[model samples]
Target: MRGYWNWLFKGDRPGLYKFFDRWFVFHVLVGASLAMLLPLSLQATASSILLPLASVTVGLSFAWSGSAQVLLQSAEIEQLSSFRVGGIEEYVYTFQTAVLCVLITLVSWCVAGLGVFDLVWPKSSIPCVYGMVCFLLFFMSSVTVRECWHVVVGAQQLLLLRYKVRMDAEKKTNS
Candidate 1:
């Protein structure tokens, strides 16, 4: 438990990048497990109740993950100096990565709706079940969007810090 929490909120340190790389795998495994369960759980019940619960769970997961990401990025920038990697590029890369994820998910949802996933996903028992699956996809999609915003905001904060440091150094040099 201690190690899991540490991996989730890594501190500023030389090995922090390695920490993130390893924990990224852990997070995906957890997320994938949870995501798979939601669809199956929805299949067992009426969407009216299960859908809302799944939606809330998805939202909370995103918020929790996004906060964790912000904390990790903050610690990283503090330790490494965003100027070293060009904060703008980091920001753009983060944004692009997020956008790509969203587009892929959206396309997947559309394809599934058009029966593209029939070869894979089991057929929903009823129209409401289909609706429930769609809702779940949308809810999960919201998580992806928030995660991207998390990256953008995190990088922007680092960029501000980088600018302040540069200005301070200039003042000291001029003096």
Candidate 2:
């Protein structure tokens, strides 16, 4: 926990965004690996459905875990204003993280679809309309989750700023 706190505050310097990108890349790799290696026979339905679902599960799990980490960092930000980290930086990072999550998720679906088709059809990679719709639903889900979290963080920051100003004004009038 202390390590996370230090990373969130002390590590907020410039050039860390590159590190964040790398970190997100690692998660995407995990999702892609899962999409490639998953055995379709394990699922009840056709391999096509099972493979993409499994890959999407893996991607969402990674995104949710990373989001939790960011939420924790945001809490630490609320507590440690003296750290000089700005909310805008946090918001920007959150947006970038969300975008990465969506991209990786889409890639995972693509890889899983290709893998499934390669196994079942052995020649064609083109999926039917149903397959395309399923993938679109998964991509939309990732986007929705990412956007919702950003809105939550932004709202929290606005409320905190408002409260701080109100308290400062009250103190001035009291004095």
Q: List candidate 2 segments past 4 Å from native.
A: 1-83, 114-154, 173-175
- Which runs in model 1 stand beyond 4 Å of their true positions? 1-20, 39-91, 119-146
lDDT of 2: 0.47
Model 2 residue 117 distance off true place after TM-score fit, in angstroms: 8.9
Best by TM-score: 1
Per-model TM-score on C-alpha atoms: 0.41, 0.34
Worst 10 residues of 1 by lDDT: 11-20
List RMSD in Å for every model shown.
11.3, 11.4
lDDT of candidates 1 onward, in order: 0.48, 0.47
lDDT of the structure predicted as candidate 1: 0.48
